[model samples]
Target: MQTRRRFKQTKTLSDRLADEAARCRAEARTLTPGRRREMLLRQARQDETAMQIEAWLRSPGLRAPT
Candidate 1:
């Protein structure tokens, strides 16, 4: 059994995101634990970010005419 490699991000978010996405696609071949976790975390982060943005949009100070 091989150990799953951990990736380090030293570049911009976009760059790191693309690299991570590529890794996830490649890892589907092996079904590695690390890749699964990474994909789930990435999805969670996206969901959280969207929620925050929606909340901000609904705030009185930022809300627009409906």
Candidate 2:
């Protein structure tokens, strides 16, 4: 019998935010006009947050000291 891997790696914060944004956009596509607008706004905000997180990750201050 083959054993399945028991440990799963967790997603990073930015990845999670990006996934949420994508899911929100996909759900918005199925909604009526008014709800779609609200969902799109939420998706935009999530995308913005993901962008900010990515920027922070690239910031020099967070780098390891040589």
Candidate 2 Cα misplacement greater than 4 A, ranges: 1-9, 61-66
Q: Top TM-score: which candidate number?
A: 2
Cα lDDT tens digits for candidate 2, 1-66: 999879764986677777777777777877788966696967768787877978888888897768
TM-score of candidate 1 versus the correct structure, residues matched by position: 0.44
- Candidate 2 yields a Cα-based lDDT of 0.78
For candidate 1, list the clashing residue pairs, or say none. Answer: none
Off by over 4 Å in 1: 1-33, 63-66
What lDDT score goes with residue 30 in model 2?
77
lDDT of 1 by residue, 1-66 (tens): 999999976785555555655564565546656767677667656655665666677678984669
Candidate 1, backbone clash total: 0
